[model samples]
Target: MDDDEHLLWQRVLAGDDDAFAAVFDLHASRVHRQARRLVEARADAEDVTAMVFFEAWRRRRSVRIVNGSVIGWLLVTTTNVARNRERSRIRYEGLLRKVRVETVPDHADEVLDSFMRPAVRGRVREAFDGLSTRDQEILALCVLEELAPADVARLLHVPAGTVRMRLSRAKSRLRAALGEDHGRSTLAGLGGTS
Candidate 1:
């Protein structure tokens, strides 16, 4: 670690705001440039840059300050934030498309109205919130993003079969949480079935 980096981090740990700001100023430009390369949108890159700094501040104690340099950590966070933004956008678009196209020909009003109910939407989000982080992550990738099992496995560094099995277990847990029978038909709506 650079001696200067070590000094800055030590001051940051001592609650020195000025020291933290100095660190931010020193790293911001390089981080922003890298973030832009990953996200491909100036506004998104800016947001990701801001988020990276915010996360660094929020988790300062846990940050690995190898050799008094946080560049490596910031780069990793930038990649993850960019990917998360992309995934969220994809999931939102997928759900929006599904809402537009999915309906009962004769009972369109009922179907749409049921889905639009605030209570129903809240219940679904609540069910997801209740799941373990691993389950939630796998479900988000496999179900919301409609990624294949192998793809999810590769991204998460788990075996393909584990991804499949975990998705099945997560779905079962979701069904139990919401007291709903989300079997093949519901999984079909998500663009896959375990």
Candidate 2:
């Protein structure tokens, strides 16, 4: 949204590879961070981040800088990439289990467990698990990935009004599950609240 980003976007759209590289350099770290938060795995996050940029390059012509910022688009793309990776991982793990393969690492559970406090994380996970798949995806795209409703709509191929409506419903459900006070405190604890 800054002047530099606007200039870079203009040059990139005008077929300047250097401008595209500059934009990648500036945004890649943030994209990776968002992916990491959503997927909760460094390797998966890295893969998702790479895929996000790859998609950006593929869709470069269609990307617009309407609000002078490409960040919202980037975040939404990263969220989708992360979700895809997670789904694939889940399916692979299920297959492994069905095949009677040893899918568990000795330290894997412990490592993931250490990512959050037991009580707060448990409650949040419960809340997330209760939501419909659509609700979960929107919540991750908007709240976790920090994409605006319009950007989320663009990424998910939905209308902006639908995004707004879904987001409102998702928030209401999450709030009801966590309770208003506990939800605010837990979000603050997760560093998601301002």
Candidate 3:
């Protein structure tokens, strides 16, 4: 037996959380790598890794340590967990296919479904393009890049209030170009207001 591993396992058996954490830290990456080899998605591999550790902790008393290390057992459990998850996923996909349903989108459904309409996007782009170069720069920095007004002012070598004013003017011009109601609705829809 590896004396360190034997001691750690004994501590784990004695219900030491730190010992279990140490064991997990020692083996988790190896288990995750094994799981990644067996599963298609990184997320699925991560899930399998978590389940392997959970199973180890849940059945700690029965977990077999091989060659004075628990890694061999953890790796085997990782494979089993990955296989079980893959089988469950296949069954779920099959059931979904059997019960597939289709529905036509209504106007409200269509509006809610899409983030922005193509026509609205075109108009917004056109409006943005029509702005002066300075306005465009200010808008891009403040809104698109999500920079703070103070940061933008520092970057442009201007006062913070000047940056805010320029941003306000750019937004006003865009709103005017898009028309009042349409612009407000569009901005609100996109989770922004000016």
**Which one wins by TM-score: 1 or 2?**
1
Q: List the residue pairs that clash in candidate 1.
A: 1-67
- Give me the displacement of residue 121 in model 2, in angstroms: 60
lDDT of 1 by residue, 66-101 (tens): 666988888888889888999999999999988866
With candidate 1 superimposed using the best TM-score fit, by how many Å does residue 142's alpha carbon deviate from the native? 58
> Could you arrange the candidates by TM-score from highest to lowest?
3, 1, 2
Q: Give the TM-score of each candidate.
A: 0.50, 0.48, 0.54
Task: State the displacement of the C-alpha of residue 159, model 2, in Å, after optimal TM-score superposition.
Answer: 78
Candidate 3 per-residue lDDT over residues 96-186, each given as its tens digit:
9899588865697576547466876788889889989998898788887889999999999999999999988887787788898887776
Whole-model lDDT per candidate: 0.83, 0.83, 0.87
- Clash counts for the predictions, in order: 1, 0, 0
Give Cα distance to truth, residue 42, candidate 2, Å.
1.7
Question: Where is the poorest 10-residue window by lDDT in model 3?
Answer: 185-194
Task: Kindly state the number of residue pairs that clash in model 1.
Answer: 1
What's the residue-level lDDT of 12 in candidate 3? 96
Better of 1 and 3 by lDDT: 3
